[model samples]
Target: MWTYLIHGEPTPGVARLLEGVGRALEARGFRYSPEAEAPNLVLNAITEENPKPYRRRAQATFVASVLELPRFPEEPIKELYPYLVRALSNVLLAYVPGEGAAFLTLELGHYREKEGEGFYERVAERLMPIACSRLVIDNIFVPDLEPELWEGDELTESMYRAGRKLKEWDLLPAPFPIEEILPPEDLRHVKRLYGIGGLSYGNLSVRKDERRFWMSASGVDKANLKVIGRDILMVKDYDPEKNAILLSVPPHVEPRRVSVDAIEHWMIYREHPGVGAILHVHAWMEGVPATPFNYPCGTYELAQAVAEKVREAPDPTRAVVGLKNHGLTITGRSLDEILERIEGKLVRTVPMS
Candidate 1:
């Protein structure tokens, strides 16, 4: 997970793309400024045309900016926040542990043309739902020196209560069946699941049977030397209707309502089209620098940033980095492939200060 800013010259194609964009700008009775800050408008113009090459160039330019630019000034973390925020969402999705599933959904309207709507309101509308959905109960008042009730055991219970209430209201996402399957006795695959230590629990995804996929059950730690079938949990006939609703599981024990983040995962499948499996794990140490700053991970901006990255990446398989404090999401054509990416990222990632 490298982070920085990009600047200087961009791909020659980008310059050509910008030239075309500049023409479109003139057509719209707008003009580019001679100032250096004009690149932002030029880039926006390129997006308007929506050409493949131009978009590719834009992505390359963005990556280059990220790879090359200096650190963001402290005052503007809110303004110049990088796609890193969404990357954190991706990470947290991966490591969201438990028996249920988690996902993410982008507010398609976020990218829609809003004419003359206020930017702040548009941003709020697009991002706030994704953020607030996780809050469970709302509108409660809090006293100074006292935290909101959403803390610890009380908070956990409240979350469950909220989940139960959401389920009653039919507000939760449509669930995909989470079935527990006995994986074939392939020691290699077993080793892959338990590669980081603990037990040998493997994942296998089935797309031909879109209604169902297999997962190792809760309580069956992948590090255990032997994992039995009884330990596996099955979520059957999930998303049978293929609706937009997403499902999630809490991080605690037993069967609970699926996670609100499940919509994000559902969106991944929708956006990527062929993505079949995902592996998530909460990896520590990725947030060494922010630890001192007390900067939290997994916020709305992070989710949006990562969702855009996932949508833009040539292959979701390559989008491994998530929020620093959260975890990882690895998607691929099969469970084995997804798991490999998850393990590889964890094994190779060296923390930054």
Candidate 2:
């Protein structure tokens, strides 16, 4: 059983919202307590007018508000809030104050009865799992690579053939039920990788051994990368002298080329055995360290420059290097470590000048 305390002043609408939220929780076997119970969660809801005019691109005029969890005296509640927000679809902001409390803001429009039920259902689905498990959710956001402006006929044919081969091997899974795991807002990242709506630009790699690593294939939709052999390529036989990076395609499987960033990943892994994973994303991060030179993408010079920067970095295990005018290359000791480092930094596109 779990206990909760509802915080914030109650307006008529807010009161009704709380009741709806309570019913949703009760349906899931969670109980509410008026007394301050140890290990209890708080639901802070607020209703306020939009202080500034909505942006020209904004879809709605009104905004709903959910406050962040206060700094609980216990460490578990304090640590649990961050993971909770990751699964909430309506979360607007999850901010942590340096000296005080951490809070989450959920934006809602003017609340009607139907809307209230939907909102409570969303909140219950996202929060109950964490509340029960008492574990932090480990969902990582890997940004998608932008669509390549040009595609050769041969390349398209090759991808089609590979897709068929994947089907024959029974490697592709059904469309991901992200709603079961994450909130709707978080689904955008998954959709991008699945190629549902837009082209995603990025490559993810995991080191298999000293000789090889597994990486996303060039032109493959990342969102569909739910299964291996169909969505990923095994990169092997790295020969720096010849700049040859080979894929471990099966005996009957048609060969697929590794990501363009393979060489850069190879150079880093070859130099740093402790590095276990690498992620390359196309976006501009405000404060990550940048490479001194801007080399063209998919070139030997670019790979060499990136490797050199990684060697120079104080903490290569968690270092994120900016590829001037291109994107970012991040390395970590393991995949989880890599995800933890790039968690909030993944973005869809670079701003235009």
Candidate 3:
């Protein structure tokens, strides 16, 4: 799962040293085992820990540790730990030189899942700005403070309890999805959706899935939202004949024009498959291109520029600051992921003078 380099005083009994390393690792959510028993001369002995564990043993070396992640070797422990220890050994090392054993612990923060879709890379690319943002809420505001048990894809009350306990440990929620409390009229016909946003800053509307790409009725603000039948706005339903072609226009509305942003929303869905939802905002310094367009202004150049920007992006799913002068487009299987990106991007930006 992760790796850590522990530095300490060498024990007269090598076996004791091994045991101490194992216990230290276990305390910090890692496992360790000695690799060479007394026989191999090259190494003293070996052992393994839960999840993933590794050990290194060589004669005349007090340097030993537990490793689980594959990418760790590129940045081995012996070299990294000493520097960390030189600075923190006084407070962190567990043993005294003549008294027995002590190790300077070097833990891998936040294990990144490496097997699928460059998840860690994506997180690194996307969250860097948020990780260093100024708009971050105080650690006290973090919700669900404990480690959530995966309850078949849904979090439960017990999980909530665990989170509360974790709060006692000071580990706050690192990221959460964005939420907009919409009104009843817009949500009446909706079955399922990912992202939710305020209509008039309070009334919320959600995009529908599986049937049509219907959104919420216009003029439904969240503050005074009422769950009435007219709030739902069913824009398009599944044709089952034309390969999922999306259609707009309700045919009966007065001004006849639905949200002008709908076409831009559709363009994103067409370009990126598996995009569950889209959030288009007309924020300042965003949503306006720097150069002039030759045609009706909705040119292929914008889409190409966006694709290129994301392709070159450090994180594919992250929201770019000033994408082609357009606001921002984020995608995710869940709404929180998208929201986290939004908040993170906002935090990363420094106000321009």
- Best model number under TM-score: 2
lDDT winner: 2
Residue 300's lDDT within candidate 3 is 35
Per model, how many backbone clashes are there?
52, 13, 30
lDDT of 1 at 161: 40
Ranking by lDDT: 2, 1, 3
What are the Cα lDDT values of the candidates? 0.29, 0.49, 0.29
Question: Relative to the unseen true structure, what is the C-alpha lDDT of residue 344 in candidate 3, on a scale of 0 to 100?
Answer: 23
Off by over 4 Å in 2: 1-200, 226-230, 240-242, 346-353
TM-score of each: 0.31, 0.42, 0.28
Tens-digit per-residue lDDT, 1-353, candidate 1: 11112133434433432344345444444444444321222232111112111111111111111111222233332222222222212101110111111112211000121213342233223222232222110111112111331122322332234334333433332322111221233323322422211122122222323342323332233232122122222223224243222222222323322222333444455566577655444342242222111111223234344456566566774455453323444467755454444442343232322
Residue range 128-234, candidate 2, lDDT tens digits: 43344221111122222222311212323333443343344333323323355455545565344222221224667777778767676655664344323435666
Q: What RMSD, rounded to one decimal, does every model reach?
A: 21.3, 19.1, 24.1
True-structure lDDT of candidate 1: 0.29
lDDT of 3 by residue, 1-353 (tens): 32323333323443444354445444544433333232111112211221111122211122223222223333333433433222211111222222322222222111222323433243222222211111100011111212221111121222223234323333332211112222343233121221112122101122345433333233332122222223323334322342122333323322111222333334444454555444433222333222221111122343344455444545444434233222343444334344445442332221121
2 or 3, which is superior by TM-score? 2
Which consecutive 10 residues in model 3 have the weakest lDDT in total?
Answer: 133-142
